[model samples]
Target: MSEADGIVYSDVKFTRTKRNTRGTTSSEAEPTYSEVRILKTHPSTELPGSQQHPVSNGGSKVTPERVVIVVLSALLAAAVIALGFTSLDNMHTKQSFQTLRDELEAVKRNLTERHCEVKSYNTVQQTSPQPPVVKENDPCLKCERGWEQDGRQCYYFSIDLLTWSESRDKCRQKGGDLVQIDSRDEQTFLELKVREKMKNDGDMFWIGLTDSEKEGTWLWVNGSPLNERLTFWSASGPDNWAVYNPDGEDCVMMGKKAGAPDLKCWFDEFCKYTRRSICEKPAETGHFTLQCV
Candidate 1:
């Protein structure tokens, strides 16, 4: 018998045969016996009268500790993959944010440049000198050939004598009316101009003032009542004097007299009295046409 891994097996057998010890003369021995021995390399190897054992792969047995190690390794690998994806997503997000920031900066720079340009243009416009505007057709120079212009108005001095009514009609035919003196400046101007045209104290020019409607209520020819505060009546006239004729003088005239009070040159007379007249109109403004005689 032999031993292997502390396991051994033995076989014993008995056989009946002719005795051969005497070479052909003696009968077989009374009985013959034979013995056999079996050996095994390890106890786990299956034997005729031994219990079976669990098999192993490549002579290596599996253990619970190794299985746990393998499962843990699988989980770690999955975690690493998930972390990699998360990192990639974070990187992409950061890039997108950076790109947006760059775009915003560019837009801000463009807007700032445009604003500066506009400011510079406005400054140039404000600082540059501009030429003065001159009107092509000045109203001050618009008087006709025969009419005399004075302060935006034109005057026509008549040479023929006529009644007050006839004189007003003639002035209307020339697109004007008898002069209405508004200010002391105008009154002074008329005084100086009439002083140049006077032949004698009796020679006078009929103005557009009358009191023919009532006894003493004077009014301009345009129907507005006279401003009594600005009248230029002589010191001792407008007395409704009835000495010269039965009817009182109701028309007004302007003239220069010797030794007269300063700016006192107005006198009342009959409407039927004939006298030269002074006509007036506003200077042309090109808005409408005035057909003058």
Candidate 2:
């Protein structure tokens, strides 16, 4: 038998028995055959319900649970990488902004400092001393007693208490005459000075303007005519010798008090009243030229 048949026969057996009947005389020889069948089951080496075919161990045989876990782990790793990049970007942006802000602050501070420095320099420049433009000429002349030098002219505030004619003569003796106010500023200045220095109350002061030498012809001691519009005379003033002096009224005198009236007389005899006087000469022009030279 083949090896496969032998293995099968080894698990099975057959048995048989024979019986003889009497009455069959003469040599009743009865023959009987017996056969016996036996079945035997063998124990297999593998356990019950075990796989009949070998299973392959390839990567395709992975379990569902293991696949889900691997996918989740990969997703988690990607999330972490993205978060790291975002954090780095944020940090870089913050640093750049901080640097810009610091630079701006430094620029502002420098500008402020420069502005202050310029202002200080300008202030110093303004305060520095500058030279005078006018030159000194003849030393100021000293006026005689009762006379004072004002500007380039000598002025006398008379206290002599003399008649109009005597006053005129006195001014001539001093090489000057009654004062003439050439400008409003000069007039105001002289008025203030005279008021401050006056001693007599009811006295009248002689000014350079007069119509005395001729009727209605007012002239200054310096040979300049009085400007009728500029004369500070009370209404209807200079009406001296009303009948005999129809015109020839000359000589002007101002009252000592504020709002005092002006008086004009043809004769020097009326000058006895105390009055403030002013004298003037052409302003010295040589000094200005010498300064330029």
Candidate 3:
């Protein structure tokens, strides 16, 4: 190949032998040589492809299309795995909530059924032969549920402890105040009830009377002066032997003795101490008749 006139030219040689009339061929007698030049330039290298790209893994080049497919497949697999776990977690949470709802429904059903049943077959309220006319001294009245009836009053004994003021507030909420003993009969009745409630031991409880505002000048919830004539005090009672006795022993309390079933169980206590309470209020008409529960 050569370059001439701003164009590339190629030369090719050829040999030819002359044929004899006698049908004899001689290669050594005649030989011919010819030169041919290519006018157009020819390609010497291969062309690149648009349909594919090369990828290598230390072996042979691979197609870019195949590599993309593999990457897409891996991503798809990871997405599928993540979705599977998320869906499973959601299902578990749904199941847990369903179980809780079922348990709550079951508890509600049990409570509804229990509320339908009464305490006992023999438990029944008896209306008086006629509505008893209430009076001031010896009134005939009725009590409410969880209260005891005595003459014209309704009394309630607390099972929990509260400070004297707290107990008074609670009693007032129930339409009463801590008990105020008016007579020895009332005191005896209260003592018997207390003994019945305490079974084996004695418990301290608060009353309405207090000397808190003014020392020694005790008063009742009705603002009545203490009935100094009719009183119950044990041996060395009202001694005010508390820690800050004379000053802190402002609230009145009742303490029972195992052997002493007397009204002399009264004592002075700190108004801040937590203790049971006795509440009393005037009975209402058509209220429940008191019975031992």
Task: Give the Cα lDDT of each candidate.
Answer: 0.75, 0.56, 0.74
**TM per candidate:** 0.49, 0.40, 0.50
lDDT tens readout by residue for model 1, 224-278 = 8989889998876687777876788989988885664377899998888899989
Segments in model 3 whose C-alpha atoms lie over 4 Å from true places: 1-140, 199-202, 242-246, 286-293
The global Cα lDDT (0 to 1) of model 1 is 0.75
lDDT of 3 by residue, 1-293 (tens): 55564365555555667677898886654445556655666664656653555665578667999999999999999999999999999999998998999899768645543433222223433333443454453222356679996655779999878999999999999988899999987898888888777634447778888887787888998899998998887676676566664466888888684885867888888788788889999876444432222
Tell me how many residue pairs clash in candidate 3.
0
With a 3 Å backbone cut-off (N, CA, C), the pairs that clash in candidate 3 are none
RMSD of 3: 19.7
Pick by TM-score: 2 or 3, better one: 3
Prediction-by-prediction clash tally: 4, 28, 0
Worst 10 residues of 2 by lDDT: 284-293
- Model 2, span 1-293: residue lDDT tens: 34443233322233333333563435434444444444445668999888898777665767999999999999999999999999999999998998999899768645533432112334444564342233354332233445554545657777666655667777777666667776654565566666666665555567767666676687877788877766655555666644454443456766545544232221221433444454443333222221211
- Give the Å error, residue 46, model 1: 99
lDDT of 2 at 45: 95
Q: Which portions of model 1 show Cα errors greater than 4 Å?
A: 1-141, 285-293
